[model samples]
Target: MAKRSNGEGSVRRRPNGTWEARLYYEDPRTGVRKRRSFYGQTAAEARRQMREARERLAAGAPVADSVMTMQEWCWRWLETTVAASSRRPATRVLYESLVRSHLSLPPLGQMMLGRVRPSDIEALVLRLRARGLAESTVQRIFIVLRMALEGAVRDGLIARNPAALVRPPRIERTEARHLSVEEVSALLECARGTRYYSLLRLIATTGLRKGEALALTWDAVDLDRGELQVRATLTRIEGELVVSAPKTAQSRRVLPLAPAEVEMLAAHREQQAVELSRVGEWQQDGFVFTTETGEPMDPRNVLRAMTTAAANAGLSDVNVHTLRHSAATAWLEAGVNVKAVSALLGHADIRITADVYGHVSEAVSRAAMVGLSDSLREPPRD
Candidate 1:
């Protein structure tokens, strides 16, 4: 046994041959008594561990606590932390779905936050991959988990976030499908007699998204000017149709309406008037696209109508969005610049327009080459 006069510590072996050391000091900030212990079979080992503990306390390093589990911290994090931060309703819903569906109750959540290692995150990702989740979805889950643990680190709950040390799975990008001109014609011809035929034609010609088309009002259309104003979109939130601002600042746009489309819309408006007349004192909403009862058409119903029209046209697999792509392709083929096409499609950037529709420009280039060949031909000397 060794003891220093200044109240520094030493280890002593008891009669039972067990080595133990006890050290007492006052907390520098609060002047409270702080006691620590080290136990080992040999006095030397106990003394060494006691010295390490004292050094760590002096350095203000955190000691790992076995009681602090990931599950506990996550609950506290969601309640005390995330609840205080303002997030969009849609974003909050997505976060709740991810946490409840994937992360809330698990061996990973049960493990102490400090004890969780990078290997644990890797194993979790493997499990997600085995369950048929796409790499992108698993990567999103990893992001949510990392953010949650990072929050814990900031709050002094954990020493470090293990999730940050793991790599997320790589995601594969698939090219978007666009309809050919023939396919577009076939689809339009199939929609001929159906109520939504004009709607499909409008989508194909004007490149209006389904939401934008559904949100159209009679006031926004200028038949004489051959233009339609896109100022809002009908989107479903919490299972109810809500009219909201355009998806992006640039999404509000004016689209030219062909004379034929104007006529079709005129006839459709007449039909809607007759239907509204039969409603007998019902309030009339001035939406250009609506149900027979003069109520705004649900975007889902518009999609279904388009799907049925495509099936009748024998283009069973074509989605409503394919019409928007077809319209962009048509404009590109007609020599519209990528920037002009980007504006027409309400894309945030011309690069997006070029990336998706640049292939159509190849036809324009071929036509130009033919024109150059004809103009460059040399006349006979005579």
Candidate 2:
């Protein structure tokens, strides 16, 4: 038997030759009695562990509680933290879907959050690879998990963030394809009589993203000034269309409309007015581009329309975004400054514009040298 210290508790030697140590203290914050215990073959080891436990509790560290599973914490993390962030709605929906459909399964989701190790995350990534997920998607999952675990650490629910120790899969960049001048002309000619003629012309002339184009409203268009303001975008989230702020602050830009594009948009507006009047009870969304009933157009539907228009135009497999690339490439070929192009495309940095359009400029420079040589070799015909 051992005497209790200051009426706290005792470390006593049991009959089986093992020592039992118990401590009881009232929590300062909760005012509730808290108890802990340690067992050891020696009283000294038992007392040491017990003292360490008490110190840990006094330091405001989390005691072992009900184990929080990964699936449980992930839902709470999404609902309570991620859903309230300034991220675009599409991004939030994608994160939620990725967690639910892929991450919350089997050994990974069933594991306790506190007990999750780096090896577990690495294994999850490996499993994703084996399951044929793209490296980019796997990397995104890693990022989402890292963010969720970081939130847990910030909330003081976890002692350490295991995600910090795991490495994300690497992704390789694929080269973007741009269209030729003749191809752009042919595509524009094909869109001449279609319902989306103005929309196609606008995108071909300006390098605005698909979302930016869809979110355009009549208020953002200034025909008098020959400009269009890009302040918001329409994106699909969980199969629902949502209008939200642009992905980047730089993405909110004003693009100058070509003369032909402005005239085409004016004609299209008149046609849309007639169509809206015909459908008296249809939804009247204020979108610049809409379905016949004035409802917002689905982006995927627009993509399909673009594809059909391209095929009809005698172009093979040219995507809608290729129109934007063609616009940038054409401008670069015509001696536009990279900085101006960067501003037109709403790129965060001029380096991005240069990286994508630099080759076109190089070809232009080569042609310029050829022209200079031809002029010098004119033989002074006098």
Candidate 3:
């Protein structure tokens, strides 16, 4: 066979009937002729892969040795990169689960890192969707995969991130569930005399997230001044409770408390003092919401209690987050400044507040439309 030109690789059929394309190049250090081969079921496919490899080489992208599998690089990338990042413990756990359980599955994991193509990623998405995973879940998986592969690119393990070229599954935006003011009243009534009563009321009035509310300490609360400082959040990581900083720097802000909330907290504090005296040696965790022993309230217990309260109140599909949603909706409808609402909700930006709750106040929107229409119309005669 005649020798091919420098840029043109040679394609040939093997005895096993598979096609292979070979690219001959000089070793940069040794100046010795070396060859790399790409195999495919068809000659055209192999040739195309070889052409891509040649282009990548011409562009100065270092080709990693073919011995490194996707699984190997992914694990290395996770251990040395993602695990060392400053993300929350809960977030790190989720990332770890995605890599260990989903990304390292089957033929994809066994393939060479440099040989992973966009079609492989697309197929993975299809398989996940077929397995009944939600679109949002699949999208999250893709995010982890893309980030890990980006690390690979940065590490010079791969010339490019194939996952970057594949589109993530789209998720439909659904309106967040919230209770009405009357529903909130009913749920609170059901929660009355229970340990979570004060906690539920605080969340409903202040719009704090479940974790943020659970993470509160007495030192951060000022009953006399009617203020609550959001300093941290509580999350469950690997079956253990983890207290971490707020989701963002902006999430750690001071929120004004209503007069009623101040009174409720004062009474709760007195009640706690009584309970502490009875116990004689309380753990004194200093959290605003705690068990009878003064330890931080377990979020799971709170969730269960909230679920029961919601059921008793005759509200369907309500959860702890409903308290926050209800507060945001009520405030927006009451004409509170969007920026104020954003700050109160601890959202990183006002746009998030507007996007989530802007159209949720249907009654307010209707009233504004009617007022505008009436103003443009002729007034009633006296």
Better of 1 and 2 by lDDT: 2
Residue runs of model 1 more than 4 Å from their true location after superposition: 1-91, 109-119, 143-170, 281-285, 361-382
- Highest-lDDT candidate: 3
Off by over 4 Å in 3: 1-60, 379-382
Off by over 4 Å in 2: 1-35, 38-66, 314-317, 349-362, 365-382
TM per candidate: 0.70, 0.82, 0.85
TM-score quality measure for candidate 2: 0.82
The 10 consecutive residues of candidate 3 with the worst lDDT sum are 58-67
- The collision pairs in model 2 are none
lDDT tens readout by residue for model 2, 90-178: 88888889899877898989988889999999999999999999998999999999988888777656667899987677885554578
Write model 3 residue lDDT over 1-382, tens digit each, in one string: 8754555667899999999998887554355667888999999999888888777767656534345887888788778897788888888888888878888888888888888999999999999999999899999999988998888777666778898898777886666787789999999999999999999999999999999999999999988899999999998888788899986989999999999999999999999999999996798679889998988889999999999999999888888998999999889888889999998898998888877775656677789999999889987799
Which lDDT values do the candidates have, in the order given?
Answer: 0.77, 0.82, 0.87
Q: How far is each candidate from the true structure, as Cα RMSD in Å?
A: 6.2, 4.7, 4.9
